[model samples]
Target chain A: MIQKILNEFSVNFHFYMKLLAEHIGIIAVSISIAVVVGLWIGILISKKPKLANYIISVVNIVYTIPSIALLGFLISLTGIGNTTAIIALTIYGLLPIVRSTYVGITTIDPSIIEASQAMGSKELQILYKIKLPLAFPVIFSSIRNMVIMTVALAGIASFVGAGGLGVAIYRGITTNNEMLILVGSIIIALLALVLDGILGIFEKLVLSHKLKKIGYKRFTAVIVAVIVGLTTILVTQKSSKDTIEIASKPTSESYILAEIAGELIMNETDLDVNITHGIGGGTANIHPAIEKGEFDIYPEYTGTSWQIVLKKDENYTNDKFETLNKAYEESYGLTWRGLLGFNNTYSLGIRKELADQYNIETFSDLAQFANQFTFGAEYDFFEREDGYKALMDAYKLNFKKVRDMDNGLKYQALFDGKLDVMTVFTTDGQLSDSRIKILRDDKEFYPKYIAGFVIRKDIIKKYPELEEVFKKLENSISEMDMAEMNYRVEIGKESPRDVAISFLKDKGLWRDKDE
Target chain B: MNKIIEYDSITKSYNGKVILEDFSLDIMEGDFLCIVGTSGSGKTTLMKMINGLIVPEKGNIFIGGRNIKDENLISLRRKIGYAIQGNSLFPHMTVFENISYVPKLEGKKEEELSEIVNETMKLVGLPDDIKEKYPSQLSGGQQQRVGIARAYANNPKILLMDEPFGAVDSITRFHLQEDLRSIHEKTKCTIIFITHDIYEAFKMGIHILVMNNGKIEQYGRKEEVFKYPKTDFVKNLIAMAKLS
Candidate 1:
């Protein structure tokens, strides 16, 4: 496992560097803002003891919110990507800083304050010279904790379409690649340790009498300059015009689709292309991001777009594609293009041994034995409008137990005997395993989830040639072709980009400019 | 001598418990006036009022014939030095920084502040080598001397000491008292020193004011107060001092 991870690391060194830089950028900006705002609040409450309890309690409450939930909530207001990520991280960073600053100042020897004040020092002077310097050790320790916490929490930022090392972990999970997950985790841990060591040095320097001669204000100015410089460089590095931004859900299938689209666009045109992989909530998040112009295009499904994005209650069929496209264009200024010709519709899978013993070949056949089985599905499937409740009511099936698990882990759970029946996408590569049998959806209750590209209308207008490139992919992939691609990536341990390129090359879709 | 500080009919209380009521006093310039009292007798409160650290519920305090209520307290405090008991030296600051703190605030040039710090340290018998040592690095006696040096560094006309040497050993306290006396004689700054030790007051003060229950029991020259006590509390305090 370690060798595989090391091999993966060497191969993707540049990719890891970009992720590391984004992670650091997020942490640096979040912490800098937290320090300024938290110190002000700490000083304010320290001066007014009556407000200290109330303000600290409020910050404490905010701190108690789970990081993922907070990010999800902020997505509505701040949209997705780094803005929402940074805002959530900054909120998390505040409690430690504010509490420490307040505690540090308030816990100072009262006699020292009396001495400084008796010397005719103004309130501000007493705070800057006497109180802050004395409280330096305490405040610095809390900042260290906050920095480390931010480093770990920033991993979740990738879930909302922000760039970070979390892309590796999420991609690894979705593709069932443990090596990628391990590599991403190790890098995050090392980054935290490195930052902590840097802060330790700073703490030592600031507290030492040698650095005292330099003046605290000047020292603070240098730190602020460094943070501002980093943010500027990172922010300006993202070029806005004439560049295509592509997003992918946290699935190997979505990742492969995105890479194919990106490769084709960059090959066919002079446009710069950047793909953000493994967005956390998949279509639920990527749709909003595309609407807000944070992303220009992403691979989405017809069933998901219709039921979840459009909030349609009616059953969706292949004939409804035009209506879905029209609704998307009218409501969200998004256009669906390039129906990938594969329907990765939701289906049920049972352990092969259990299926053979019960002779459950279809949904109606499985309904009789549903009471004896423990069914498992991804968390989103439980909440979607056309998801768990609707499917259960359609089949009139009631399982003895229903377990919510990650989409990536449901197949593993089924094989492990933890789940007798699990929800599976029709084209999931894991279904190729002999231990699991794909049950037929005889009732045809699930909508056809034809994979396609959802592109912003403005982007299509800007790059008219992109439409032609997308048109080449329409009705190009079959169910067997998609499953083969997924199996090569997941079971064969092949890179998604490699699988996509190879598949496109075999299909005669690869544009050879040199030829 | 001109009256340096005059408190007229001052009243202060906490939780309806009277600390000082209808209190009046006059401190002459260049006099080392030691106000001796037990805890709660309001000696610290009275001295703090001269620096405007404490405000009386009623009455006015005049410093150099100017009403302190009308004075900018920051400037007023700059003109009056203060030191207190129990490790009051700023632990984060070096001895020189602690001593020069007031001078720096007074907008003295860096060189002048250093000179003032040096002179004050020398006056308090601190060696020049320990100038950069933090208060926590120093011994208890050394910390006390640094505190006193900081109070005297500003060259103020009035210096307030609230048992500044109370935390030190007897030998160190005796040395601190002697050094302060010589400092007082040389600077001729009016000093209002509060101590619970009557013997300390009598030994260091030229004018001794004995307080009992927030009121002055006796106010006179040290020799006169020792020779003749006007109240039973003053007589008993002197008797205790003599016995100790």
Candidate 2:
């Protein structure tokens, strides 16, 4: 199984390299901006030594915020992807860079400062020639530390659609594929090590006055120049094609359905489609991007609009689609396209061992013994409405503890017996993993959540012909068809694009021009 | 001789503590004036006032017949060289860079800067090749000569030294004093030095200002101040120095 997963990476080496560059680029950009801004702030604060402590206190508080919680808070202003990720990571990188800068400058010998002043050095001159040059080693070491930290955190940023190796790792875990996670993690760890090593050499050069006289700093400059040159070439080359952005929440079914739609669109049209998958905060992230026109399309569920968007918790059997479509039009200025004929609602599941031991097959039956088992769930399953809070209240049950596992790791955690129960999507491919058993929702706490395309309203208006072409996808996929597609990509370790293309070919919706 | 520095009734205080009150003095063009004072007697403040490193609360300091408050402070400092305590050299710079720093700010050409650096190093009795060494690589005596060379590079009208030999060993400080005496004779620049040691003061100064509680007890040529003790503070300080 691991070999099959490794084969997937080798087959798509070019595409994965682009993704890796995108990840590291986000981290590099964030660290660069943080160093510049943090230094500026540190200098300003250090000037009024009285204010330095207070400013550092504030930065300390900001640094203490959990990364996931911080990302959730920043999602609204910056939205998903690189903007939000860079902003959050930059905030996280600030403390060390700023502290180093402040301490480095402040600790300079007063006699040195006096000598510089007595030599007729202006304030700016003293800073550039004496203070900053003296502070270079300290400042550079702190920046190296910030870079290593930002690289690790960049993975978490992938959850918000920032796109990194973390995305691949999450996809791996959600699919319960061990090898893919191993491949992604090892690469990320190694990237941090290599970068720190290079910067370490640079720091030593700064401290050695004799080596510096002969232009030893040029060694560090050369490395920077090469990385920047390659990143610029690759990034420019990657974005050279006019691409349409499609986004999806972190789930197998969402990825498969979105991939199918993307494939169908790309096959019929000349447009290059860029799919940003496994987005955190679900529609909370996607709707704003769609409104701002960052994403052209993504597959979204209807019940999310009714319950989460419209804030109506009660499940209405009929008119769910109408109310959701109207809310999208009025509230978000987006359009909900024809359904794919699936309602992938949240459902409870247990390990097969527990299920067989108690003969538990329904939600009501589990409620009696809920306290005997620990619950695990994805972030949104515990955060959003129609999620853990509402579900538990509706069922009038409580588990021993509800762990907020990442959506990708929930299934794996359950199978490993780390959790007795976990929340799963109705069409989750991992449902066939043998170790997991589904529990029927006897109380029906969740609303009808029919899945379909959510497109920017302006998109259809601009490309009117494309709207009709898109309508062809209406009811083209059933729940079982989607589950099968997800199973192929998630469990079979096939690429989402391959699964999507084969599905389109089987349905006679697409044909290669050469074929 | 024309006066190169004059302090006019300077009053300075910090945090409600009076450091100097109505302090005034005139320094001749080429007098080697060493100030001896108890701790916190404001001798350092008086030296700093000549270059506007410390601005007085209620009076003006005139350097080369110009009021320091009216003159641009940086320009005033460029004409008055300063070295203080253990960190006389900029640690990150080479001895050459440290010596040439003031001249570079004056926008001297590269050749001119190097010429001035070499000449000043020689004047301070530092080895020619030591110009390329960082302060950290140099011995304490070598760093002190580099600091003196840096001061001489500007060809300033006055030199201010505050405890410049305090961190060096006695052997090095004695050598540095000999170097200073020779450099002083060659340049003929007015020097104002502060030292806690009575021996250092007597050896370095042509004229001495004996101070206690921010007040000058005696200001005259070393022999005259030694021959006539004006106050009990000066008599006791000199007797104590002789015994030590």
Candidate 3:
């Protein structure tokens, strides 16, 4: 799997290089802006000592907000891409820089100030000539802290079409391709290290004014120039203005479904269609964009929209599709383009070897020996209302221990025998390759989370034939087809677009217009 | 000689507590005047008020026969040289830069400022090589010399020194006191020197002004202050200096 990932990297080396550059470029621009402006604010507040606490308190509040949520909020104003990313990252970057500047200037010896005043120095002259130079080291150190944070946070910028190495990481996560995740993570880490190392040199030079080393900043600048140059190439490579923008949550099934829709539309019509997934905050992030017409469509689960969006409880119902249809149309002007005939509901799974040992085919059967089993699940599953607690309470099963692992790592832990049972989505690509046996929900513990398209209602109306052509996807794909498609992309080393196109082609929904 | 510095009914407070309340005084030209007071006695406030570093809330100050309030503060400050204790020199600037700063701010040419820096440094007995060194590299005595040189850079007519030797060792303090007295005699400039030490007051000042709790305890020639203490604060302060 690692070799396959590396092969993919080599094939897309230029693209990856450009993406990493854009990532660093975004960081460099945002951080520089933050330092300059944040310092001014710091100096301004320092003059008014009484206002310092209030200003910093407000900035501290901004820092406390989640970066992704902040980005989503900023989208309304900045309207997307590098501008929005830079703005959000700058806000996060300001807190430390401002605080440090304030502290650095305030802490200078009063005698020095008096001496300057005695020398007939103007207030502005005193600040620039004396205080700032003395305060550089403290301020730079704080800026270093902010740089590291901003680099990491810039990964979320990919959601609003801000291209960066985050694209690879997001792709890796959504497809369950661990090697891609590792590759993207390593590059981002290296970029941060290089930038920080350069900053350290600048800090040192500021303090001692010594020629300890030659060409340190120049060398760093060259590397940055190269990254920026390559990034420019990759950014400019974006073509196809005539495109329907489809968005998806960061999930394997969602990505595949969106790709399938895009493939079908591009193949059947003269119009172009493309998917931009890995959106932050999953449904919460994508839903607003779709409402604002920034995105045209995405695949959502019925259970999620019902529980999260409509605020429903755990009562299972067959009339869910009708209620969701009415609410979405009236409230959001969105259309539920019917189910894809697959129910990717939540399930509990154990290694087949362990299941055989315990003779557990159903959740009720596992309940007797539940005390002997150790469970692992994702962080979201632990918090969602219809998640772990509900399932455990409804099933009346108490496991020996429950560990909250990452979504990707959960299956790996179970496979390694670290976990006796783990959470699984029925349509997960990994389930096809693993010897994991999903326990049947004999007690009907989970509500149906049927997968289908949630498109802007206007798009369906504007392209009336879209409603008919899309409804053809209703009851079309089965559970096996979804699992197979996910597996092809996840383990078979095929791209989601390819897997989707192949599936759509086989279903006769994708064909060249000439053909 | 003219009253180069005249403080007229100056009242100032911080957080509703007055530091110098309704105070008035006159400092004559060419007099090495020492204003002696303990901490928070508003001695520093009197010196700072001359340079307009701290402003009086109620009344006006006249420096060199001109009302300080009527003139541009920047030009006023340029003509009024001020110095303080240990950290008076800027740590980031070299001795030369620190000394030349006042001259530069007065719009003197760089070549002229260099001459001023060297002449002032020589006047303060600082070595030529120390001009290139930062204040941090200087010894306590050297840093104090740089501070004095910087104050005299623009050749101000009235110079203020607030406990200038307070932060140095006894030996360094004695050396600095001698250097200051000689510089005062040579320059013939009015000096408002503040100190809590009675010994420094008597040894340095030609005239002594003693203050306590924001009011003048005694103002007279050093000989008169020594022979007759006008207030209990002055008597106790003099007695304490004698004991020390």
For this target, which candidate reaches the highest TM-score against the unseen true structure? 1
DockQ of 1: 0.81
lDDT of 3 by residue, B1-244 (tens): 7887888899998789998877888889899999888788888878888877788889889877789778888877887788886677777777887888877877889789888988998999999998789888989999888888888888889888888888889999999999899999999989888888899999999999998888889999999999898988889988987887
Instruction: Give the lowest summed-lDDT range of ten residues in model 2 chain B.
Output: B235-244
Candidate 1 lDDT for residue A398: 98
lDDT of 1 by residue, A35-89 (tens): 9899989988988888999999999999888888998899889887888889998
Q: Across residues A254-319, which tens digit of lDDT does each residue of candidate 2 receive?
A: 777788888887788777788888888787777777888888888888777776667885774546
Among the numbered candidates, top DockQ falls to 1
Mind giving the per-residue lDDT tens digits that candidate 3 earns over A1-515? 67865887797798688788778778877887798899999999988888999999999999999877788788777665677888898999999989999999999987777677766778899898888887888898998888888888888788776768888888887787877777888778888898899878877775775532454467668756865675466456445566778888877778888888887777666667856767767787677778888788899988888877788766545576888889999999998995798888888888999888878999999989999989889998889987888888988989999899998688788888899898888888777755798788888778887888998988877776677668778988887789889889888867788888888778877666654
**Lowest-scoring 10 consecutive residues by lDDT in candidate 1 chain A?**
A207-216
- Restricting to chain A, the TM-score for each candidate equals 0.87, 0.80, 0.73
Kindly list the per-residue Cα lDDT of model 2 for residues B96-185, writing each as its tens digit. Answer: 888999999989999999899878988888888877778888998998888888887899989999988999999999999998998999
| Candidate 3 chain A, run of 10 with poorest lDDT | A209-218
Q: What is the TM-score of each candidate against the true structure?
A: 0.92, 0.87, 0.76
Which sections of candidate 1 miss by over 4 Å? A213-218, A348-423, A432-443, A513-515
Instruction: State the displacement of the C-alpha of residue B208, model 1, in Å, after optimal TM-score superposition.
Output: 1.0
Candidates in descending TM-score order: 1, 2, 3
The digit string of per-residue lDDT tens for model 1 on B23-142 reads 888999999999998898999999899988889999999999999999999988988989899898888888888899888887889899888887888888999999999988899999
Lowest summed-lDDT stretch of 10 residues in model 3 chain B?
A: B85-94
Ranking by DockQ: 1, 2, 3
**lDDT values, one for every candidate:** 0.89, 0.83, 0.83
